[model samples]
Target: MAAWGQRLAGVRGVLLDISGVLFDGAEGSGVPIAGSVEAVARLKRSRLKVRFCTNESQKSLGDLVELLQQLGFDISEGEVTAPAPATCLILKERGLRPYLLISDGIRSEFDQIDTSNPNCVVIADAGESFSYQNMNKAFQVLMELENPVLISLGKGRYYKETSGLMLDVGAYVKALEYACGIEAEVVGKPSPEYFKSALQEMGLEAHQAQ
Candidate 1:
């Protein structure tokens, strides 16, 4: 798993995790944490691929690009994963459009999911992106579908930010599951599905992992 994290100083290769790995602390301070941004720039100079695999869940690549730029890290939309897009890709491929419950930015990506189908993928991310209305619809849809697929398996509560510790998306996800009486399907990595996809994206062969 990339969770072990590739060595930043030595490798002229993939750089996963944008905020903490590239910049210091968390959002706002935008200060480069001890050689983090430099490490990325160094890789870029050396032509190494820096793919930022984020469980960020919400926010579009454009938003990420702007934030990265604020911190003086030169990044593009291509090297990021906000999960919403990946979710849409999954549901679309499954031939199902999900009635999503997530942040505003994340909801944009749901356009790709086929809402007309009975199987609706209910989604949620951190922050105030989700609301009562969305959750209501999400539960209603789940009741109809009986087992709505969840996009994120992560239940992490709060991440450290420049300001301080804050709530993470997991809380809201749990709330929906409680109301809907269904569990979510995790689509991204660390989950075997996502982890394998990361490896495949990196063009690495998967051996037996303990």
Candidate 2:
């Protein structure tokens, strides 16, 4: 297997994370870090495949793409990837249909949302729509279902700058877990499958991007 830094550093296709790598998160504002927009544009001009990946539970691939473009970074829908899409796959495999409590963007990935089912696959993206109503519903579903899957797109205060780390999916996920008394099944980053999918899309083998 190839180490990620080694192989990726030399590849034509480079997958960049939006919040930290491209933009500082503490800026809260949607725009990317100052030079990031231009830096990404320059990479594109070099004929490299650049995919901006984010754990943002709020925006969808299409939405992020548009935002990036407006912020001066050139990108497309197919060039972006989010954990919600992967969460959809995990839910399907479990044969569990969730009364999904998510943003319109997250909900858009699913074919249907069964409101009655107590079982839920919580997908937290820290998006703008994340609210009390949504959290309450998710808690209720977790309380009802003995074991609900809480697939975190990624954990941490992804956005950062000069100040310090901020609250992120981990905080929300932990709060829900404590309130519901049911542990969640997280499926995201450091999850080999997620990395595998990213690598595969870039036309590289698993070890190739180790």
Candidate whose lDDT is highest: 2
Instruction: Give me the runs in candidate 1 sitting further than 4 Å from their true place.
Output: 1-12, 24-31, 46-48, 206-210
Candidate 1, residues 105-168, lDDT tens digits: the string is 6555565555775577556563665667766776677777755666663556766778878776
lDDT of 2 by residue, 128-177 (tens): 55689878877776666655555566665444445765666767777776
Candidate 2, residue 145: Cα displacement in angstroms equals 2.1
lDDT of 1: 0.63
Per-prediction backbone clash count: 6, 6
Cα deviation in Å at residue 77, candidate 1? 2.1
The true-versus-predicted C-alpha distance at residue 203 of model 1, in Å, is: 2.0
Winning model by TM-score: 1
Candidate 2 structure, TM-score to reference: 0.76
Those runs of model 2 whose alpha carbons end farther than 4 Å from true positions after fitting are: 1-12, 24-29, 111-115, 126-133, 158-166, 180-183, 206-210
Query: CA lDDT of 144 in candidate 2?
Result: 68
